[model samples]
Target: MGFSPDSFYIKTLGLTNTDDAEIWEYATTNDFVIVSKDSDFHQRSLLYGHPPKFIYLRVGNCSTSKIVQVLQDEIDIISQFGDREAESILVLS
Candidate 1:
């Protein structure tokens, strides 16, 4: 399932250029999954565990299309990861 930034108050709350902590807090409060390529989120996931689960993309320096393709290809695995109770961080390489 695709999510619009507006649905999570990302645009409404003016989260542009905000720090990771604020974004994390919002995600936690709203029960939204964090999908990012940033290691900061990955580290936070490792430290805090979950209420806001994280999907860390390990793909290095690629075009936006490639990134989207990778995510599309792995949607099934990603869905499973999101649904799993014990899993919080999904590192997609």
Candidate 2:
């Protein structure tokens, strides 16, 4: 549903069901960084401008653990740039 900011972790919002736009809005409202495999998120970010922050993984392919670690590794770095009024995007590969 949602994740704790301390965790900087994703609470899988589900799949084959939830719409990307809804998820995007949810992330913005909840102040949760989206950790998704879909490239659509990036496209949407550009189209709608941006939220406080976003993380888009451009890795071709990888294990879930690897993806999670990538996010974990950058949590602090990204957080430093996070601001409610300042939208941002962090791309990791």
Candidate 3:
């Protein structure tokens, strides 16, 4: 996938237990997009909007491989979404 390591949630970043607000702030400051199944970010996007855009995974219970496959299938859509300045959150299942 040639993605340039934008996500900062690995254990090395020490964000394993960080709250949403802190994660939100980090993404905003660093121009990172937050991708998760957590609906908190969806609510946040509704209230705040843009800058640090988000991708909400409505993919109920599934393995990481399944999620990865979903993302791979939607790579074009995701790319288009990333390019759209007016778009903020993308809900992928």
Which model scores highest in TM-score?
3
Please list all clashing residue pairs in model 3, or write none if there are none.
Answer: none
Global lDDT of each candidate: 0.83, 0.66, 0.84
Candidate 3 worst ten-residue window by lDDT? 1-10
Q: Score residue 38 of candidate 3 by CA lDDT.
A: 91
Better TM-score candidate (1, 3): 3
| Most accurate candidate by lDDT | 3
| True-structure lDDT of candidate 3 | 0.84
TM-score of each: 0.83, 0.71, 0.88
**The 10-residue segment with the lowest total lDDT in model 2:** 1-10
Per-residue CA lDDT of model 3 for 1-93, tens digit only, reads: 323355444345688888889988988888888888999989999889987999999999998778778888898999899999999999998
Model 3 TM-score is 0.88
- For candidate 3, the per-residue lDDT at 80 reads 97
Off by over 4 Å in 3: 1-10
Q: Candidate 1, 46: how far from true, in Å?
A: 0.2
